[model samples]
Target chain A: MTFTGLVGRVFMLPLRLIINTCVRLRIHPNTLTFIGVLINIAAAWALALGKFVTAGLIMVVANIFDFIDGKVAVELGEVSQFGGFWDSVIDRFSDLSLFIGLIYLYSQLGRTDYVMITALAMMFAIMTSYTRARAESIIKKCKVGFMERPERIVLFMIGAFTNRMAAVMWVILVLSVFTVADRIILTYRELRDARQVAA
Target chain B: MKRAASLPARVLWNAFYWTYERATWQYDLMVIAILAFVWLTPPDWLNDPMASGCGPLGWVLAQLR
Candidate 1:
């Protein structure tokens, strides 16, 4: 493996340990995943209150739990269809809540310009994931895009920590929308090709 | 059942496979990093019209002011 992959694997060691512990204790991965979602929602709510640093810290903690859940599932051999589905569903909600909180914050601050951008960012963020999900429903492949969930989370963390609300919103809006469009076009071509081959 | 793959088909398949193998992980990570940086650092120039040189968007906002 490359150095980066090695690093990623190393970073995941603690998560694997947690997963093993959970498995030994008979704790379900889905339960941990649900708890992670709850933590994330609470973080988003905190962000809405302008507790940016607190929100950022909470998000980091929640995401660690999120990572652990996957490892736990693997260790416990409890990876289920519903587990993946619920995780994804909650993830979307978590993503949306962050931007929604920001929008509410900007609105309360009377920052109209920033408000629209924040709303747009939230919309685009949802659309980005939606495009990928929709495409997967039709195509067998997941199209890689410029912006993905990890990137979005990083952006939000940066914004929270730096107090760069408006800039973050603008970046998310532009990049997420672009990613959505790119995925849609990719899916359309793939599906069309598949149809042509069948015909 | 005996049809041969066309040149375009072969080329496209190879290209897709190459891209899938080579770029997916790194590209996704890079995009994520860019988003993180932008979000974390809202440029001061964005909020300051004078600093931003009254660019098109800034100029328009200035008109409203």
Candidate 2:
């Protein structure tokens, strides 16, 4: 295994321990998920204000909590349909609020182009998630894509920490759109094959 | 005498299987795509937004200066 993999495993150890503790305490996973979303919103707002390093730190910490919620849920045997649904819904809102905060900051800075691009990226990102949901609903497989939520969060952190907000927006725009397109194509192929067989 | 299923019936079964398999493929593909995107993208691309030097990065650095 790669050194980074080893480091990641080591870092996750403490988180796992915390999750176990939460489980033993019988804490509700949804509560932790909500807390995670709140932290993400705060971190995003900090980034929007150009507090890059601070925002990056907060984002990283928030993501750790995000990861822990699921483990906590599984350990506590408190996983429920509502728990997953709540997480998904809050995640969407958290993502939007974060970008909206950036929009506010960029508007204040008079960078309209960056604002537009960021908005586009945000739209595409949301669509990417929606496409998967819709495909699944239709009983078709459509999960082929290059960007996912974890990567998106990491990219945001990198942008905030390194102070390269434009680059982050660009990456999000390209990858998120690509992911959406990938899903559409996959869905089309599936439906087409099904049709051919029916004929 | 045992008779083979009709062509229409065979086609229907194949179609059903195809739909099932494709849906399963899509679900798995989404997971793979996400992983690849995150792991493959360059850090430089990730850093571009702040590179403009006129946005938040600039504002923060200006305060320090």
Candidate 3:
């Protein structure tokens, strides 16, 4: 096995057991997804309260749930378009909540600049996902960006834990905007090529 | 005017599709990084609302505060 594969196997051993138990409980993956978002709401609450460490730790646990739902879905053969659609919708909400928390804290701190930047980051972050979804509507596959959701979550986690949110906002803003642009260009090219070939 | 895929277009396509294929693994690495950073960073350091102890981040936060 490759190094990451080996590591994933080792790490997932426990998660696999948890998922098996979750499956036995007959819990829907969507339920797990819902639970994860609720936990993330708690994380956002922590952030708004200026409890950075608390927020970070809670976010860590919350994302572990985020990862688990997929495994549970795959293991139980519950993967469906509806399931995926709901998960994506919920994920956007989850991302927004976290950014809202950060914005709240920034506003409280009277960092109007950071607050605006954070708002911009949140908007572009949503656009990052939106561009892909919209592109996928017309193209075969629209997975063309580096600043996708999971990376944004990780970057936010880093900023929260390390108290480097300014750095996080800058990264999110630049990369998310770039990602949106990348998707637009990629989809445009793909459609144009398709039209040319058909013609 | 229509032509074959240019070198730059081909390069971009390959790079993006390659990235797409390995996106899961990349996400895994980022998760590991976040967890490791959280574990290593002291609670006090992380809990500093104003980031008063970090380097540039702290300086920026201090200015904002």
Q: Write the per-residue lDDT of candidate 1 for residues B1-65, one digit (tens) a residue.
A: 11587887875443333233323565445545555555333255566111224334455566799
Better of 1 and 2 by TM-score: 1
Scored by lDDT, model 3 comes in at 0.78
State the displacement of the C-alpha of residue A49, model 1, in Å, after optimal TM-score superposition.
1.5
Best-performing candidate as measured by lDDT: 3
Question: Which candidate do you rate higher for lDDT, 1 or 2?
Answer: 2
Candidate that would win on DockQ = 3
lDDT of 1 by residue, A126-164 (tens): 888888788888888766555678768867887788666
Off by over 4 Å in 3: A1-10, B1-49, B53-65
- Candidate 1 chain B: worst-modelled 10 consecutive residues by lDDT: B48-57
- The full ranking of all candidates by DockQ, starting with the best, is 3, 1, 2
Candidate 2, A81-137: lDDT as tens digits: 988898889888878877987888888888788789989999999998999999888
- When summed lDDT is taken over every stretch of 10 residues in candidate 2 chain A, the lowest stretch is A1-10
Model 2 error, position B13 (Å): 32
